[model samples]
Every structure is written in structure tokens, then in C-alpha cells.
Target: MTSLSGKNAIVTGGTRGIGLAIARGFLEAGATVTICGRKPENVQNALDALADYKDRLLGISAHVGKSEDLEKLISASEDRFGAINVLVNNAGTNPYYGPIVDSEDAAWDKTMEVNLRGPYQLSKLVARKMLSSGGGSIVNISSIAGLTASPLQGIYSVSKAGLIMLTKVMARELGRQGIRVNCICPGVIKTKLSEALWADPQAEKQAAAMKALGRVGTTDELIGAAVYFASDASSFTTGAVLTVDGGMVL
Candidate 1:
């Protein structure tokens, strides 16, 4: 296992699913973690679930789309765990599940606000702190959807593709400053956010058969990739996109 001892990390949208898995994996690897969700109850639930870590795990309620909230989350994380050296931009949303031409303006705005803009703003804030504190690593959780567009995922695919580009830009700009930026593009993970694709019996079977592994990915399966990015194991890896998609994209 990759070790993150003495590292301070922050995970957004960490109340459940992949974000929660990444947070737990970070703690298991011996890092101090601060996680945030948009809801108070979800934050509390995650706090309770990770109680064994005690103060090592801090849970906060913050909307990634709000700059003030992001500021507060970062400030509180630093106050509790010192300088954050690992940042996981995992928060995202796909409010619409329809054709691109039929999509409304509000859907596009919200999708970009949470999926792309939030990470852009947060990375800038974290990179400045990282520069002051020596260096850090950033892992953006994009999706295979970004690599290949599918029906009903047009806006989301665009936003995620933009995120991948953002990762590359940040990595190139920050490499000399010691900050490594990379992206993970997962496919058909079994999470609530993807219930529409995996919940129905027929759809689930089709989804499974599409993957080389013959099944959808679990949240825990993405942990190892995240750990790699958070640890020195990926010290030389930047501006790269790791796909953990069960070969569905292949």
C-alpha cells in the first residue's frame, strides 16, 4: 500500500460513494483528512462512520460551487491538519439525463458550476497554499464519459472533458513549483450518482456486459488509483489521466 503518513488531504463530496471511499483510504494510509458534503446530515453520517479516526478525520458541510464555502472548508482543514498536501477534486453533478439539444440553460450552468468551475477555483486556492508550503498533489476524478460521449451524457461529458484539460494545464504550470496534477477517469461505477445507469436490471446487465471485466466498478476499486496520486509513488506522474473503467472504454 502507498503510505501518506504525515500528509494532510481534503476530499470534496465525501459524504458517500467514491469520495467517501477515497477519504477512508487516505485515513487507512495514515493521512489526516478533511471531507465535505453539501448536506449537514451527510457530513454527520460520514463523521460517525469514520469515528475510529477521531480528530484525524474532519467532516464539513460545504457546497463546492460556492467560493466562500470552499474558503471556509480549506481554512478549517488547515486549522485542524496543517497545510493540505493532497487535494481530490471529486465533487460532481449531472442533473440532466437527456439529449444535449433538449437540455436547458440551468442544467448546463449547474453542471459546469459543480463539475468544472468548482475544481478550477479549488485547485487555484490549493496550489497557492502548496507553493507556499513547498509542494503538493492534486487528483481530479473525471469520467470515461469525458473520453467518449454517450447518449444522454452530452453536457456532463463536455464538463468532464474540460476538467481533463484543466488538469493538464495545471500540471504543466505547477510542475516546476512541485505540485503534481493528474486525473482519474472512471467508468460505470456502482454509485448513487450513477444509479440511472446501474439500478435497472436490464440496464445493469447491459452495462456489465459492455465492460471487459463483465461488471461495473465498485467505489473501493478506485481507491488504489487515488492512493497512488496522493502518495510519492506518483511523484513523477503529472498531467496524466488514469482510466479505471474495467476496460469498458477500450
Candidate 2:
């Protein structure tokens, strides 16, 4: 049982799916959490749903791919909660799902900007604060697409793969400063973002057969790993990638 009690956290793309699950788990573990989504209504809905936590939870509308929005989110987290001790880089986008040769420049750039660049920028901002405040943990929500090639997801795969290396770079450079950086690669989660893979009967069956667990995973299934990475349980773990993919790659 890991605990994040007394910790302050920022979860990006936290209004729904995996990010929302992570935020709920952090609140349950006694941490003050600031969650952000691009849409104001989604943020408000999340805030209302999590109102039981009262001052412990804050919801902000921000786009992870935008530098100015990212800055505001960090400032808001500090103003409301204090020095951020945990950052879960869960915001990601997959705009063009096609062959790499077919991907246009805009598609490639958008995928990279949101999935890879966003995490890098957010981690840099939070790492500085962690260094000043005695260190913290960063958990990036990458995907199994990073570890292996996926059909029709070339650019998204490339972006996630880049994120894995970025995690290593950050961990190696920031370790001395007490910031731990890690990555999580999830597989076939039944979220709207992944509906195309799982909503179709043939695709879902094929995906499930590839996993040792014999089924696609749910958003809640990834929470434990995120909590572990965020808490002291993984204090010595950095630059590591944890796969919560129901053994799909195996």
C-alpha cells in the first residue's frame, strides 16, 4: 500500500479516462490534486464530481500542447496547493491514424507536439520547482505504441517512443536534483481515444488475444501503477518504463 499523503500533484488531461482515474486515486491516497483539461465544461464536471475533496482538488482548463496554458496551470497549482510534488503527464493526441508515408506534416507535428513535446515542457517546469522544494516524482503516460509498432498509428507511435527516451534523459539529468522521472506504457484501454481499436468486434478480439490477460484493460487498472510511481514506493525508481498493458507485448 503506497501513500501520497500530504503531497501536491498536477494531472494533465485529467477530466476523463486514465488521467481522471489517476486523479481519483491520488485524492483517495490523501494528496492535493490539480487536474487540467482543454475544455472548461469537462473541467467543471470533474470538479463537481470530485467536490467531496473540497479544497484538496482543483480543476483548470488548459491545453498541454500550449506553453502559455502550461505555465498558467503550474502557477495555479502553486498558488492553490503549494510546490508540486507529483506530475502525471497524461495528455496525449493521435490526430492522424494512417501509414507513416501517408502522414502529412501537420498530422506529424500535432502528434509530436501534444504527445511528446507537451510532456517534455511540463516536466521541465515541474522539475525546477521540485528541485527547489526538495524533489518530486514525474509519471508520463506513454503507450505500448512506443515500445512496438502498431498498424495505422505510425506517427502516434513515434511520438510515444520519443517520450520514452525523453524520460530517460530527464531522469539522468534531474536525478541529482532529487526528481524521479518514469514512464507507463498502457495497451488497448477501453477509452474513447482508443475506441477504434476496441469498439470493433474483430479488432477487439484480435487485441484481446494478443494479451496474456485475454481482455482489454479498463482505465482503473492503470491507477495502481500511477500511484506507485507518484508515491515513495518507487523512490529509487527513475527512467523506468512500467507497462500496464495486460501483457499485450508479451
By lDDT, who's the top model here? Answer: 1
lDDT tens digits, residue span 1-250, model 1: 3899999999999889999999999999999999999999999999998999976999989999999999999999999989999999999999999998898999999999999999999999999999999999999999998899877899999999999999999999999999999999999999999998899989999999999999999999999999999999988899999999999887
Worst 10 residues of 1 by lDDT: 46-55
Candidate 1 lands at a TM-score of 0.99
Best-fitting candidate, measured by TM-score? 1
Lowest lDDT 10-residue stretch of candidate 2? 46-55
Once superposed on the true structure, which residue ranges of model 1 sit more than 4 Å away at CA?
none
Instruction: Judge candidate 1 at residue 46 and give its lDDT.
Output: 91
Q: Each model's C-alpha lDDT?
A: 0.95, 0.93
